[model samples]
Target: MRLRDLAELVRAPAALSVPGDTVAGAAAGGGPGRSTPGLAAASVCLYWGGMAANDWADREVDARERPRRPIPSGRVRPSHALLTAAGLTAAGVGLAALAGGRRALAVAVPLAGAVWAYDVRAKNTAAGPATMAACRGLDVLLGASGGRMRQAVPAALTVAAHTYTVTVLSRREVEGATPALPLTTLAGTVAVAAAAARKGPGALLAAWYAAGYGLAQARAAADPSPERLRAAVGAGITDLPTLQAALAARAGFPAYATAVALAAPLGRRLARKVSPT
Candidate 1:
């Protein structure tokens, strides 16, 4: 497969959102350490794996609803996508093990399982959003493997809440959503912003996230069109780094938080070339 096609298959630009989860976790767990980068890399691998697995699982449906997707468009084969998913997942687990030893493995193994389960079983069920949320929550915890796990819980929950809202919105990306759907997600976004905000730079980042992501949701609520819903979903994916930055700032890491927030604009620009949703 061509490199560009592989990038599309894995939603590579969206992987920019993955590292911050680990950074937020590390901050909340008592600040980042040497293992932070390894854990972050592992998170990105798992995210890419999950995206590939998602496309592999949805290949048939995508052929009908999204024929231009890499797999459905014949730019990527289903077997190649599945292999990519497996390889990336294995690499993620290996990286986690090498970095944090047993501590990281505790979260990584389950996170990997959750990713596969979401693609193979839970994605179409009522539990889809919650399952995906759990995966994201676990990813945050993975960074806390070498630190105090209890302190990271709130941050993990904050990220999970955001993931839940995004997943709910993503469901209607192809089919238009009801006004109530965007309204509900909008409320969730407000609550997430409140949860992440605190006295400092984090608060500003939280407001930024709420404003950018919330406006898209609001527009979708007003129109509830497929196009609007897709935009909202894209905004959710790209704006995630801001939320992570807010959480990191709340955890007392302004510099790291700023670094994390920088990914937001970069993700948006990259999304123009490779859709995050």
Candidate 2:
């Protein structure tokens, strides 16, 4: 398979949102350490793996509803996608272990399991959104491996809340949603932003996140069309770094928070080339 096909198979651009989970966790736990980058990389691997596994599990469905997807388009074989998912998951866990020892492994293992379970078992079930949210929450804890795990709980929950909203919106990407759906997610978005704001520069960043992402949700609520819902989902994915940045700032890392927020625009630009959704 070509490199581009592999990229598409994993929804590569979407991985931009993964590292910030670790960053927020690190900041909240005890500020970033040398192992933070490795942990972040591990999180990205798991995210990409989840995306690949999701496609593998949805191959049959995609053939009917999303034929242009890499697997359904025949640009990527299902077996290859499955193998890629397995390999990346292993790599993520291994990297976590290497970077933070057993402490990180404890979180990474379950996080990986949750990712696989969501893709293969829970994705079509009513538990899908919560399962996916748990995966992201575990990712934040993974970054707190060598730090105070308890201190990271708030940040983890914050990220999980945002993930829940995104996951809810994602379900309606193919089919149009009701106004109530976007309205619900919009409420979740508001709660998440409020939870992350705290006191500091983070408040401004949280507001920025709410404005950008909330606007998209509001637009979707107005239209309740499949296209609008998909756009809202994409915005949620790309705008996530802003929320992460807010969490980082709240944890007392304004400079690092600014650095993380920069990813938001870059994610948006890349999404234009490779859809984050």
Candidate 3:
């Protein structure tokens, strides 16, 4: 397969939305050292691994529903996708262990398992949303591998809650969805943002992020069509970095939060070229 196909398969642009999981976790866990970047790198690897595994697991289904996807389109082999997922998972776990030792591995192991479980086992089941949310929560905990997990818990839960909302919306991307679903998630967006806004001077930025997220979901709630729901799902994925930024800001790392927030526009631009969903 060509590089473009590989990029699509891994949802390369979406990785932009992932690193802040570590940044936020590290900040929340009391400002980690160099290990933070390494953990962030590991988080990205695992995110890509999960993406590949999703494609691999859904290959047969995609053939019927999403035929243009890389695997279903025959641009990439099924075996290659599986191999890619396995290799990336190993790399992610190894990097976590090297950077933060067994503590990091503690979170990384479960995070990796959650990724595989979501893609290979639980994705189509009723537990899919919760499992995927746990993967994201574990990612935050991985950043706290060297420090206090109690402090990181709130931030992890915030990210996980948003992820749960997104995962729920994603399930209806093709078939459309109920207005109640997006409406409920929109209310959650308000609560999560309000909680983040109490963090620090960067609270304004957090509120801004929440407003944008709420408006996007509100559109879907107002008109729950397949196209609108699809747009909402895309918005959820692309806006994730901003939520992470809010968490970082709440953790008193305004600089890191700002850096993460800046990636939001770039993620949106990239999503235009390659779908983040």
> Which candidate tops lDDT?
1
Deviation (Å) of 119 in candidate 2: 0.2
Task: Please estimate how well model 1 matches the true structure, expressed as its whole-model Cα lDDT.
Answer: 0.96
Error of 3 at 40 (Å): 0.6
Give stretches of model 2 more than 4 Å off. Answer: none
Error of 2 at 242 (Å): 0.4
Q: Count the backbone clashes (under 3 Å) in each candidate.
A: 0, 0, 0
Candidate 3 Cα lDDT to native:
0.88
What are the lDDT scores of the predictions, listed in order?
A: 0.96, 0.93, 0.88
Worst 10 residues of 3 by lDDT: 197-206
Given candidate 3, what's the lDDT at residue 215?
82
TM-score of each prediction = 0.99, 0.99, 0.97
Q: Alpha-carbon error at 181 in model 2, in Å?
A: 0.7
Residue 210, candidate 1: C-alpha displacement in angstroms: 0.3
Task: Extract clashing residue pairs from model 2.
Answer: none
Weakest lDDT window of 10 consecutive positions for candidate 2 = 194-203
How many Å off is the CA of 58 in candidate 1? 0.4
Candidate 1 lDDT by residue in tens digits, 1-277: 9999999999999999999999999999999999999999999999999999999999999999999999999999999999999999999999999999999999999999999999999999999999999999999999988899899999999999999999998988898978999999999999999999998798999999999999999999999999999999999999999999999999999999999999999999999999888
Q: Mind giving the per-residue lDDT tens digits that candidate 3 earns over 226-266?
A: 88887888888788888888888878788888898888889
